[model samples]
Target: MPTVRIPGPPGLPLIGSMVDLARQPLQAMLAAQRDYGDVVRFAFGPPGLRGEIYAVFSPEGAHQVLAGQAANFRKESTLYEEVRSTVGNGLLTAQDADYQRQRRLIQPLFTRRRVDGYAGAVAVEAAALVERWSAVPGGVVEAVAEMSRFALRTVSRILFGADVEAAVDVVRGAFPVLGEYLLARSFSPLHAPRSWPTPANRRALAAQRELYRVCDGIIARRRAAGPGKAEGAGDLLGLLADARTEDGERLDATELRDQVLIFLLAGHETTATSLTFALHLLGRHPEVQRRARAEVGEVLGGRAPGVADVEQLSYLTMVLKESMRLYPAAGIFGRRAVEACEIGGHEIPAGADVMVSPWVTHRHPGHWPEPERFDPERFTPEREAARHRYAWYPFGGGPRACIGQYFSMLESVLALAALLQAFEFEAVDREVPIGQGLTLQAEGPVRVRLTPRSL
Candidate 1:
């Protein structure tokens, strides 16, 4: 085997790059890639500590870790275990066999045909959001909070059917607390044992219980409805309630709770962040916004956007793709080595953390010329076909890639088109407030001035 010889900045002792990383994560990672090449070694924890991490930031490196030798790296254990405090052994927290089984069981609910059906609901929610904005005076609207509310309402409508009001309070209350705690833990090297009665930990535990209560209530209601309910009822909760394993074993209440919790939390938050960032980008680039609005006008012709219109709104799709390329919601993510492996001529021992940052890789100078420019034309079919396969993985790559990708794309395209049709947006701030939490979000309200469109 080759000797382990990755290069990195030997950071300050005891603290070891944590200050730099915490303050400017995306810039720090990008600087490391520029200085040390594709695979850069990073030290965390105290002096002489064993916590050496590797960041992979090239298409080749990403392909190696996320696809080529994928079996050798698994989701980081400590982080996932922490997530399980709320999500339990759901798809995100499940291991090899359990994850495979769960995927099979839930896969039917997200089939292309079914996800397409959710488009009408997505457009309805977006239209309601437009109406709410119309009622308010047209000053700086909080784009981030508004998108979050819209995403939660849309997902709840799709998942819970007619019973959304029953679970909305608990879901809305629990997730912000849960996201703050998870984001802190994921970054901090010095969190106390979660069992300790600390204020943050107490909040986390309380939030977890609230989420469980909400999940339990949703499942109980579905069960009470009886399995004879038609699959055509078309809500996700109904389908999951009736899903059976290959052996014909139905999911128990606990399993049902886990799935619901993970779906509601993970599903809505990522989509909200994506939509928020997309709007921020569009608001800043009025030309792009105008072009997209033109497309929406020509295609929809004063009708609500549907799944069928997703393909026709090509520029709108390109704008969203370009926005995700620049500010990927799950920008910097992690995996852990399950066994010793070589990537880019460096040895990664089992349990060592590995990072694949879309924020870094998407901006890699080698893959994307003029990487910082906001030009959706770069995603044109001809240009995209010329790029590397792993060049722009906003939804990630490989078997463990996000399963909700199709749903998110369709939802974002429809919602974005609908918003553009209803209102024209102008940015309140010259520079956007970029924030990092469970996902990359706008730090403050992405205040935008909205003028009603003359449709």
Candidate 2:
């Protein structure tokens, strides 16, 4: 048997690499890759932890884990367990047969045809957001929070038929707790249960309950309306509520609740982060922003954008594509091997942890020229076609990829086009820090001054 050799950063006797990661996650990870080559391992957990602790980092390694031989890997149980405690058996947490069944039942709803049906709603909400923001006095608006609110409102309106403007307080109340819980789980060992009476954990549990209550009311209202009434209903909640499996089984109340919670949590947060980053990039690069605004102006002519106009807004799409490439909403994805695999001439053991980082891949020197610069032209049809297929996976690749990608893109494009048409943004602080938890967000609120564009 050939002994496998993987290189990594030096670690202290007890703490290993934990402290390094805590200090500067992106920088530390990049340093590790630089020092240790494409495939690197890092230890975690205390000295006497039951299982071995190591992480593998490489683009090829990431492909092997997430796509090449993905059947042999599962979403790490620890991550899923934490999600299960909060959202129950929704698609995000479920595994094996249950996951398979739910995915099948839900897949058709996110298909191109069904997702396209949501374009009008996305446009309407985006136009409303532009109208409201254009009215705000210029100077230091919190773009991060603003975008988060906008995305939550868009998703809420499409899913629950609830007026997001009315439900803002309720959603805002849940964010801090949810964000903290997810952050803790990402760093802490799974064996340490979240119910250990810590203040943060307690707050998370309370927030979960409150969130459940809000979703429960919406689910109940939808259920009462019956199948025929829901047929033409365009919202995600209605589709899930009224949908039946091939075997004629509907998502029961528990399943429905879990799905709703997942959509609410997963649907809006990432999209918001992406849009916030997109706008920030646009503000910094005036020429790119100018081109995008011009595209929106030519495409829509002062009216709200519709599905038909989305395809013509090429510059806006490129801006979004480049923005996401620089800062993917989910910066990294992980999977654990269930069986041994060989990838890029290295052997991966069954129990190893595999990590693919969009943060790293997007900046890979071999694939992207001047990778650190913001260049939307890289996303032009001709340029994009010539690049590696997986070189720019802001939404990921393969069958298990994000189901809401189309909806997300449509929502983002409409919002971006509308906002750019109505206003111009200037960065109040160019050095605002960014962090990663459930999504990539600014360390503090991103303050930007909004100048309404003179008609």
Candidate 3:
């Protein structure tokens, strides 16, 4: 084992680096990577207190941690624990055999052929969103809120089908609260127990119950409709309810609820963040906006985008990719070293919290020439092909990669195309500040002005 002690700033004793991490995570991370090398260490607290986070900012280290030697790492970080507590033991936080089994059963559903089936549903939601924006009193809309609404409706419709409307009310505004609650818990060294009924805990738990209640009710309705009805319903809930393992085991009621809740959380809010930022970026760059809109017009020609359009809207896809690079939804993810391992030429012992940050790695000067500039050109085929595979993993990489990636891209492309076809954006808030949450979220409204597009 190469026992070269990783270099990093040892902050104030007892709560080493916690203040910096909790105050401005992104900035602190960037500074850490830029000042220290690719593999840097940051203590979370005093000695033997969860030790220190070994952050991998190099593509090589990212590949090692996330994919190459994945077996040596486990999703056992406090952050993941927080998420598992709030949501459930769904795909995001499942471990070992549970994760493998769930992945095997759920993987087939997200195949290109099956996921593309939801494109029309995505297009319908996109069209509705474009129309909704048209009705904004001043032709100005809050991009984050609007994208959330669109993504929520679209995911709900796909997940719940006929019961879509029943879920919207309960899920709306609940995730942010849950996200804050989770983040606070994830970072705090010591906190009151969740059962202690603190104000914040109460609000978060209430939000969780209502969200779960709505999903549970929908599942119950499907169950009442009978197995035949559920299997035949042709939606996510029905498919999950009907999914069986090789041993003929099906997800129990609680298991079914877990899947639905996770799907809603991951499927909707993340997509909304991607769309909001993509539009916000476009609003700030008219040249890129015109070019992207032109591509949309040339391809769609006033017709709604279909699944095939996803391939043809190449430029727009690049724009979204660039936005995600600048602000990834899953910016920083955590894993624990299961055993001693070497990454980026440093020795990592077992039980250390390992973190891979796409936000900082995506800006590595070695790969991206001008890291801060928003240039969709970087995603051009030739450039993308030449770069390291793990250099741009907005949706994550490896065995545990996001299953909804295909659907997310399809929805984003279709939504962007439709929105571009409907309106031309002018940035109202040119610079929208952001922070980390359940996903990369804006600190304030990402507002943009729209002028209806002429046929």
Give each model's clash number: 0, 0, 0
lDDT of 3 at 198: 94
Please name the candidate that would achieve the greatest TM-score relative to the true structure.
3
CA RMSD of each candidate after superposition? 1.9, 2.2, 1.6
Off-target runs (Cα >4 Å) in candidate 2 are 50-57, 163-167, 228-234
Using lDDT, rank the candidates from best to worst. 3, 1, 2
Give one digit per residue, the lDDT tens place, for model 1 in 24-76.
66777888998898899877667654366789998988988888888887876
Off by over 4 Å in 1: 1-4, 48-50, 230-233
lDDT of 3 by residue, 1-455 (tens): 33778998777877888877776677788999989989889887556754467888999889988889888878899899988888899988899888888887788789999999988788778878877777889888898888999999999888877778898878886888998888877766767899998999899989999888887887888888877576337888888878877888788888788888899999998899899999999999999999999999999888988998889999999999999999888878889998988887888888988889988999999989999899999999999999999999988888878899989988998999898998999989988787888788788889999999877
> Residue 59 lDDT in model 3?
92
Candidate 3: clashing pairs of residues:
none
**Where does the lowest 10-residue lDDT sum fall in candidate 1?**
225-234
**Considering TM-score, where higher is better, how would the candidates rank from best to worst?**
3, 1, 2
Residue pairs clashing in model 2 are: none
TM-scores vs. true structure, each candidate: 0.95, 0.93, 0.97
Say which candidate scores most in lDDT: 3
